[model samples]
Target chain A: MADTNETVLDMEVIGALRALEADGAPGLFAEIVELFLTDTPPRMKGLEAASDAGDMPGVEAAAHSLKSSCGNLGATVLVDLFKQIEMLGREHAPEEIPSLVSKSNEEFVRVQSALLNTK
Target chain B: MRIQDGNDPNSVGEGMDRHLARYHELKDSGEMPGLSLPEPGNRVPASSAADGKLRDEIIVQLCEGVADERRVQRFREAWTKTVEIVSANRSGICERFPYDEFWSHSLACGLAAHALSKQLGRGNAEEAFLCGFFYRVGALALSCAFPFEYAELMELRSLSELDELKSVERDLFGMDHVETSHAILVDLRMPDLLCATIGELAGQADGGRSELAYLVLNAEKIAGVCLLDESRGDEEWSAIMEMRRELGLERAEFAELGDAVVRKWWEYGDILKIHTRAVTTFLELDDTGITERSLLGLSKINAMSEYGSPLTVLIVDDDPTARVILKQQLVKVGYRVLTANDGADALSCALQHSPDVVIADWMMPEMDGLDLCRALRRYEAGRLLFFVLLTGRGEDEGIIEAFEAGVDDFFVKPTHQDVLIARMTAAKRVLNLRRQIEEDHRQLKQQLCRMAELAREAKDAAVTDSLTLLPNRRYATRRLSEEWSYSERTGLPVSIVMIDVDRFKMVNDTHGHDVGDVVLQRVAEVLREATRSGEVVCRFGGEEFIVICRATTREDVLLCAERLRSAVERFVTEGLAVSEKITVSAGVATRDETTGNVDALVRAADQAVYKAKELGRNQVCA
Candidate 1:
């Protein structure tokens, strides 16, 4: 795989790394990635349950919060996937949401592995 | 004194009793009882012709007195009031007032008075007012004196001839009211000119009269005939027509003046606590004689009507309320309106709609009006949008900035609505005129653009060497002039370098112009590649080329020139298929401030080139 620097990532990813270094924890990216990896699954499960129950507001609230967190972490692809989920949840289209959540999970695993491997 | 009727027969005494009885009988009959029993102080009986003469004299004297500066000034206020009143009631009077005799007479009297005053150089404008007021005083007095007979006469004659039958007053009252009034005026010692005019007006004497007085008298006569005709007889109508021509009154103008006079009478009567209908009738009777006054009044009415028309406006402001207020006020004034919100919107709207003019606000959120104004200048939208920047900021800097940004005009915010409407109206007119001017400008710009493109094409064709695609001699001169100016401004040394193909004609003669052309192209490529972007390199016609370098020192210019010469030599020998090896002689000259002319700079470079050629044509010289 190409390095993150060579890939077209959101500009905020650099800003987040710089912020972590400025906060006196230059090697804290792995811990933050682990936190995201551990926290996002339960949120996704909650969204799925709320959407299955036809609770559109619940689905929206969960999806929106998760999406913003992913954006903050500079996980642009995940953020885009979460945004689509939020839109779908708000629009009450729960039937087409499983595949999107699966894709987000897969991308999250990749980002998590990459973070764990960082020197 | 007592009288015994058949119903109340009481006995009375001799001669004194007989006179008393006669006076009582006259009083019982509602006649002028005092005529039979005169007042104790009266030494003279009221003769009809004398009184008529006196009334005429009094009227003339009154008119003359008003001509005096003091009296005229006093009357001017009254005249203005009369005009205001008449204007206010114009529609009402036109609807209600009698169209025939009375209205015509009043208009005639007003005109006659104006004419007389003008002829006499009298400053009293109120003469028209007064003439309209009292022209029919004689007729009114007669009506009062013989009420029963006048009522009978009014009934017997048609509505048009009320004034004409006044001659019958002599038969009924033993003296007409015109004579009676004249006598009273003479008794009061009025001026003789006045007395003579009254006599002329009353037909009491064949005296010399002013044309205005005659016009008034004729108007009155025509007015009376018009009143008497129940069906408004054609004969009376013809007489009125003749009177109109005689007074030089156009028919429409006569009607308008007549209506104005009636309106004035109605208004004045209301003010003075008199009967409005009665007063109107009286004035209308007088207007019949002076047809020109009616014509004058009509022209004035037409003028007033014209002034009542609405203006057109364009409102430009970011604030909705400002636009609404401006639009409302302008609409009230009968103005057509257009509105734009901000500078960019205003500009686009102005360009698209081509409004009569633009009223723009300065402090807009996006694209301030000044920027929009500057942009508008590039368009031939006629008179450059006639931009008016309405600003709350009154700083000199802001104002200066607006002007610098190409605002044609400026207005402070919270301008009076009326003033704004007026200004916008004026702006609209100017912009409309500019529309034509802008159309002409568009045509001219189109023409100029076409010419510029053609010139550019021609220049490209003439000044580019075909094979190398480098500028020829014509372009070299142009580049030199520009470079010379740039050098002067920056005080930086500019250098011109000239290079020539050594034996270039021989190459062309041996290999033909085609290969020679190829060689030239290759040399140009090398020179272009070696030179900085800021430098100008051109084929200086045939096998010679020139380069202009900005901000270059003398040594730098020489080095660059030498490098180019070496590159051309190396490329031709190593890379090109040539029968003979090629080399170039170069010359470089830096601009000298002491001799700042481009021609001089070129000459120096040319001399250097000559020197290089003298030194065996393969090296650079400066």
Candidate 2:
């Protein structure tokens, strides 16, 4: 796995974290990352399976869930990956699923590792 | 330490150093107390440690403590002044400001600030007020500091030239005004985060902040863009993206803010009264912020009431009385009117104001209305201008020539005021309709493109026959009837042909249905080859085909149908297996004045086809 420092968080993310801390919920940071790590993988897998099976609704649901999860964690890069996946799913481009799934997995792993290291 | 005189300076100097050290420690630790310190009247007596100079510095610092507050106040004043000036002298400042960006930005910032305040649970009107006010401070300051640069920047004539401005500013000032202002804000002891946000707003290099920075930066950018009089470049857009990335802002978030901002600006008059009043007070101190505010306010007011509508009308007439009459009438009708003495002045005025419409007199000293019309048609900006030429001679040939020169509507000279207003109102209605039609057309085209894309992907063969991928029996019959009705209504001839393969079931039994399908496809191909443009060929159920031709005569239809029959027979006999020779029987029909309905015509053709099949296959009967 790549080092956490290699994945630099945007200043906005840091500021939001600081704001969250100011709101007296500093622990929300760790909680959000944990939720993302726990929830995102299953959703990603489901998205891939749904795409492979040409299950458009399922693909859309999974992609949407992953997108919101990434946003909550302030995982911007992951959010973008999920957006592409969501677009593809909405377009019903099942053929594009495998590559998008792999790319998203890589981003998720990067974000996950960074979050763990931060904790 | 024990034996100092009461006025000794050494002890006082040491105490001053100690106090200074502690202040720096608090500042660095990000724990500075709120800026609302004790008022000067409530302060304890200063010890000998603090002298007059130190006290003066402290007073300056204290005043600077409310520098953000002061700056915000200044910005509001400038904004109001700008709105007023632009509104009053619509010809002068409207030519300069164009009322595009300022309108958009004011709206966006107002809304985003409202949302952000709510999100932060700040729950006060101050944050909402500040959100709209401070959001565009960077742009306002830049415009004030470098008016000429801003005017040039607004022109945005070329990307390379814009970059040159950036480089020039850096070389001349060591930093851009955006950075300079941000640095000044920092020096004045604003919150570090807000200072960072202001820096980002000024289009400085981005650093990690949160949505607040993104919010401010985006608001400023949108406001800057809203204020822009011309097109921006890739560098500007890239800067925006980089800013977004640094602030973790999505395009949708910005769009949402933009929508909210527009809504707020739309209601700015009601919502921003207190801020506007404060800004008015600040404007009396300095002239910078008032002009912008005035122009913005004018635009808002004009946009709200039809009586003050900002749509420009360029009046071109050499006669002073005529020009005055036209301007007064247009202004009375709520149009922002510009008067030009002749065609030359009119063209320049048209280029500057980009008026929604132009009313021009025919004969002039420098250039005639016809010549101006021709010239305007050639310019890209002139294409959308609603040109209404006022001709002394409204003769048919002259009118045709004016139409050729791209005059959308025309008005006769010495026209009555009521008549002129009616014509202009008609033109406005037509223009509005044209806009609606164009919008609808664009939406329809997009939908069609999407539908076509989906159709290509689905590969459904029901509407298209399975064998030849031509229109099936149902689609063919429907299309034929449509063509027939169209031709009948237009009093044009319509033609139809029905073809049937001879002994098709025998071929299917001899060589499996797959081979028969291939033969059917081959015959269908031959039929397709024989048909002309604007003709339909389709599989009409098993072993049958139909063709519909438009504007065709009976002789031509017969010849075409005969050719199709011959081609299919020759192709099948020469190209197919030796065990079977294929042929087709065809019947052709043409509609004349006597034909009452499309179905009767088809029935007549079907009878002829049956006769040909019965007499013997492999021939055409009409």
Candidate 3:
């Protein structure tokens, strides 16, 4: 489970999140996970729709939003993929973002399951 | 120290460094003036202006180093633009921008820069003036654009040193005034070379800036020192000395420069109608920091407001997640937290709730944290809000900007709970200090009112008889003299009725002093009640009373005396051991040709009382 967690969500990011919790706090890590879970799907849909329509600015905005949320959750692979898409969108590289968006979606599913299991 | 602490916040720390630094610089060159600086009063007076032409000549003098007419014209245009911006925005920016202080410091900078340019012979005086005048234009722009934030920044800057202020501004506003000034100068169509040099020089520490930038920076420092209190910190003194030595300014030349800047500052103050406090000379900068420090060093005694009610914190951020995170952490640490989504909402919330501390995000959609802070600072109640800015930007300049925007504390994004708690602890200390100050003011006001009330009471007590609740002998004599003078002036008859209790000593001996006291009190009540308007009644002495009647005839005065005698004779004394009815002897005297003065009038009345006693005790005598 530990190895799986490391593969899905970066352990260092998890450690940092855990550190945010106080002595008797309900837990910042859990709250952040919930925020990531609820927030990411719409952003993922937005990125896919924008990429399909070849709207680079739209893709960039959606990707930018997802990157920060994924970064907080230690979903390193998704963060990396979304970062690529965001850069591509910024640079107006229309052809490359669609593949990256699918990759982000795939990695996000793994991250979601892994985060839930930890909880 | 008192002067420093009580002075303008911008002037609190570095205000006296130039003077003190000049002292050290001179000492280093073995050319120290006497330990005391020249008196500030020795400077040239502000000359009366011939209005438009003299102003133009002063402008010419400022730009003396500029030889080209076209370039001079361009500089004049720029000067006009500066004036336009100030005049146009004066009303809108009245609450946020400190217009007097901004101009005072700017004009001083222009003067100082021009002086330095002339003294060092390195840069054109016109360029120096432009650089000095426009250097902090970004500060004005920022204050106008984001008033609350800029106000907060200034507030923070006042309490902090230059270094700390730089970081705080960066944290709060994403850029410090140097960058803001650079941007503004570029936008204003200032020459690129000049703008670039100023931008380069404004941020560098101690070394590695161009000579022009160096001159302008030192000029700015001089301007700050001139306008602010004379509080010397060793750090500031060393920095100023380093700059002085680098520029090779002799102590005498520096003193002259100070005098020149102050003289021009006063002259500009008059022409511009910007109020100016007298700028102190390097030697004349008063060092009252110790007294100020003592005043500020109040013990950290927690007030009832602190212990009784939980410290309320307003957390303002556009991101709900960020707000939740901060709120949960603060609430866990025993704070009563309120949340606002953006700066505008946060401000209204702050104004309504008056939170002890405000934790706001630097970046919001419409009005950011600094804007909210500035807005909050504009209102009297919001000035004390311990604003803590949360920012994603981690730059030092950004931090300084945040402080300048009036943020008490700055935290980078993804703040840890422990960090938040620690920041809150610091916030509480600041809040306590504010509360302590307010409590001190309230107590001082109460004490003043009490003292005033006591003074009024003391004034009254000097003339009032405590035993009879009437004017005493002293008051009677003074009143009689006043009446006598009035009668003398108006040729009106003024009469006096002197009444004594009949056999008062016998009454005291028979019934004891307590019963005699009751008799005297009852007789006083009758006398007080019987007198009409224009009749001044008083307890003259033991068992004796006097009444001064204005515009009354001798016959009427005799009738009034008899009325008092008969009233006392008829009244029964109640609640006393003795069953004796209280009575009084009566005498009347009116001011006539025979009456010499007020004293003689009283003597004639006393003689009539003796005559009344000889004839019969209860009858009236005249």
Please tell me which predicted candidate would have the highest DockQ against the true structure: 3
**Model 2 docking category:** incorrect
DockQ of each: 0.01, 0.01, 0.10
lDDT per residue (tens digit) for residues B354-417 in model 3: 7888888765657777778877775555778788776542334577776786778887666765
lDDT of 1: 0.57
Task: Name the candidate, 1 or 3, with the larger DockQ value.
Answer: 3
Ranking of all predicted structures according to TM-score, beginning with the best and ending with the worst: 3, 1, 2
The reply for model 3, stretches above 4 Å from the true place, is A1-119, B1-51, B91-97, B159-163, B202-208, B231-238, B283-622
Kindly provide the TM-score of model 3 when superposed on the true structure, using C-alpha atoms: 0.32
iRMSD per model? 25.4, 31.6, 2.9
Against the true structure, what is every candidate's RMSD? Answer: 37.4, 33.1, 30.3
* Backbone collisions counted per model: 44, 37, 39
lDDT of 1 by residue, A1-119 (tens): 44762232354453544453443233455555555567667877887787778888787767765665555455677767878888898788888788887787787776555545442
lDDT tens digits by residue: candidate 3, A1-116: 87888988888757755655642344576887787788778768978998899898888877765665565566778877887888899999888777777788788889989999
Off by over 4 Å in 1: A1-119, B1-67, B70-132, B158-160, B184-193, B204-208, B218-238, B249-622
Task: For each candidate in the order shown, give its overall lDDT on alpha carbons.
Answer: 0.57, 0.57, 0.68
Per-residue lDDT over B1-622 for candidate 1, one digit per residue giving the tens place of the 0 to 100 score: 1222422214434422332343334445664222122223443322356443543343443455354675644454333333332333232222222323433444445544554344434434344334433454344434444556666666665333445666565456544545444443333333444444554555534576665465455545433432232333345545655766666766555554444444433333323222323211112223344322221222222211122322223576555534544454444333445677766555555554455456676656566767777766645442345778765423245777788877767765545544665566556566556667877988999898678769978766456665687777888898788878887888888898988889889877755554576678888888888777768899887788899888899988988898788888777665444547888999999988577598888888889989999999999998
Question: Per-residue lDDT tens digits of candidate 2, residues B1-622?
Answer: 0111332325445422322332233345542211212322343333334233443442232233244665545433333333332233222221233233343444445445544444344423233333444444333333433456555565763222232455444443233434444543454444444555555555534576455554443445544433333233345445645654554546555434443343334334222221111011001111111122222322123322222234567888765534544554455333556778888777655754567788887656568888788877755457666788865322345788889999998776445545766777777766667667767987998898678758865864237775687888878877877887798689888899988888889877755565577678778888788777967888988988989888888998898898888888777655443257788999988887787777878888888889998998788998
